[model samples]
Target: MTKQDALFQYCLRLGDDALILGHRLAELCSRGPFLEEDLAQTNIALDLTGRAQLYFQYAADLEGRGQTADGLVYRRPERQIYNHLLCEQPNTDFAYVIARQLLFSAFDRFLLEDLCTSKDERLVEIAAKALKETRYHLAHASDWVYRLGLGTGESHRRMQQALNDLWPYTGELFEIDDVGLHLLEAGIAADLHTIRALWTPEIRQMLQKAGFEQPADDYMHTGGLKGIHSEHLGHMLSEMQYLVRAYPEATW
Candidate 1:
């Protein structure tokens, strides 16, 4: 693929990850375990959705397509999406949600930091803006990881299980595809392998402080980057695309 194609595809993946995860987190808006947490989740959800909007805008410009951000987000097929498997996984419980956020935000924080220096001016600007938001997200997730992990016996057990259950999907976050390779070679993207090094240590330290043990790295699940997602994504798409599907040309 050409450099522009590769960069555009990579941006779409970033956008899809933020969009899908934001939708999942939005489901918890008024349903958080506590009032304060409900507000916190909603705030994060807004941030993710806002980030996704920015990504889709850039993706549209890069693709040179007439598609608007809303169209790209709400009208795309499953295979066209490039989110990591971890982001699309089911939000089982509070602890599970926090685990997902902890892992994703930590990875994103480093990714954005590196992207802020990209040779591509637009990407560098987007990354610089996103870096500020991601920093807070990482802090929020880290705080929750500690609170749930070091809380009461039940809370600790649940958080630990959440970590173990979600561990397999974590591998996909660092799985670079063909597009990523092109971007990396062009100096428009960060090396996922290098980011992984930083991500692992930060995650490990957070888990340790939370009184949680790392899960055995037995099998690593992959394929989401290639559009092969878990069953959960279909349901998420159904709900997210409901209005768009129902009224193809309807506008607010």
Candidate 2:
């Protein structure tokens, strides 16, 4: 594929990841265990959704297809989305929610830090702004991981179970395909190998401190990068894209 094509896919994957994950977090807005934490999750959702918008805008420029961020997000079908399988997984419980957040944030903090040096100015700018919020996200989620994992017997069991279940999906975050290789050669992307190097130890330390054992590398489930997704993503889009699809381009 051309570099332009690679960049478009790269941005699509990034934007889709953020948009879907933001939607996941937003689902917790009124349902957080308490008011302050509820607002915190909502604020993080805003940060993620804003980041998705920035990346989608860049992707639209690359595509030159007259697509706005709203058009790209709301108008896309399930087969067109490129988010990771992990991001679209349902938040089944608070332990699961915190485990998912901590896992993603751990990798994201390092990944965005490296992307800050991208040759692509737009990526660099977006990464710089995003890194700060990701750091906060990691800290918040990591604290909860520690608290819940070390708290009571039931909480500890739940936290460990969540970690074991989610570990398989973590591998996909660092999977670099041809598009990523091309972007890496152009100095517009971080080396996923390098990012994984940094991410592994940091995440392991958090789990250790939480008194949880890291799960073995078992059978893994992937395919989201190639537009294959879990059933949850389509269900999410039904709710999220309703107003945008129903209204087309109504300027509010």
Give candidate 1 misplaced runs (Cα > 4 Å).
Answer: none
Cα lDDT, all candidates: 0.88, 0.91
The per-candidate count of clashes, in order, stands at 0, 0
lDDT of 2 at 21: 93
Global lDDT of model 2:
0.91
**Mind giving the per-residue lDDT tens digits that candidate 1 earns over 1-252?**
888788778878889989989999999978998899899998888988898999889888887858788888888998888899999888799988988998899999999999988898988888888889889988998888878877799999998998999999988888887788888888998889999999998888878877889888889999877888898998999988999899988995
The digit string of per-residue lDDT tens for model 2 on 79-191 reads 99999889998989989888889889888888899899999999999999999999999999998988998899999999899989998999999998999999999999788
Give candidate 2's total backbone clashes: 0
TM-score of model 2 (CA atoms): 0.97
User: Could you tell me the C-alpha RMSD of candidate 2 in Å?
Assistant: 1.2
lDDT of prediction 1: 0.88
Q: How much is the lDDT of residue 177 in candidate 2?
A: 92
